[model samples]
Target: MNHKLLPLKVFLLLALLSLSQMFCGINIQTENPTADPGFMATGIAATLTARAVSITPTVTTEQATQTATQQPTETESQQPVQTEPVIPEAASISVSLDTNCREGPSGDYQKLGYLLPGQTAALIGRNSTSTWWYIENPKKPGQYCWVWGEYATLHGDISAVPLTTPPPPPIPIAG
Candidate 1:
């Protein structure tokens, strides 16, 4: 046998032995036959040898049952209930005239919906300059839009109204 091929053969043998031991749950014993310095001096190639050895796993039946029947502690069993941050209804705005609710702070934005005369909406936010009030649209449930402050009367602290970045307009889907 070529001396160059001896190491590769030894490596493959050791790897196969380890994999078999892991998957079959069998214990293995390995010996390097040419480990002695004099063996190589005598021109003998290095060889790997292995044999099966018995090793019983240490897991006990009582330990296994205890692990399977483990109960959660009181802290683990009870979780803190989560609640949404209450944004106080800071203000409500009533439209003085039929006004357009736009997607953004400016009139240049596309109209999302409308605020009718005498219609009131909850104030959500305002622009940096406080010229716009972002409000929840009464016409569209669960939807918010913006109306010009000039055309509406604010019923609460306009300063307490949080400023918000307006959402982008919905992309028009082309049919």
Candidate 2:
């Protein structure tokens, strides 16, 4: 191992390790498993096996007795429960020009209906690139369609909009 090449060798090793981990879906657990950080990846292939433990009857009895004896205090019962405020996601867009709404994010999809200029529609979601917005079909109620984002003026935060799968085309009924 040349001293001058040590840094390069270390960098190459790290790069190879990262690439291998990414391809193999192997994640190294750096923190305690008990503290769930919400963002941690699930369905991990690795497993942690714990040694067997024996508990006496007296300890179990005492624990149960303690739990049974505990009761909610008057103050605790009177206090109002705190809840997170639900912030409604903005999912509405105004059509800048009269554009045909399609079943999917692309023009190749079947045209569901037309969104008139200056008309507003509830945005359901967007494609991967956010180039198109999937909105509720104004002409046909209960149905949803996609419109090009370039032709529409979004009123709210487009990032808040969810990604949704486009509905399947309606099968034609043969007369």
Model 1 Cα lDDT, one tens digit per residue, 1-175 = 7875575466556656884666587434444333445544333321211111124234666555432222322222234455556453358786646789887888678787888754668888998888888887767878888889896767655668897987675666689
Instruction: In model 1, state the lDDT of residue 64.
Output: 52
Candidate 1 colliding pairs: none
Quote each prediction's TM-score.
0.44, 0.45
Off by over 4 Å in 2: 1-89, 167-175
Q: Which pairs of residues collide in candidate 2? A: none
Candidate 1 segments whose C-alpha is farther than 4 A from its true place: 1-89, 168-175
Residues 35-102, candidate 2: write the lDDT tens digits.
33332222121111111121223354544453222232222123444556645446677654589988
For candidate 1, what is the lDDT?
0.67
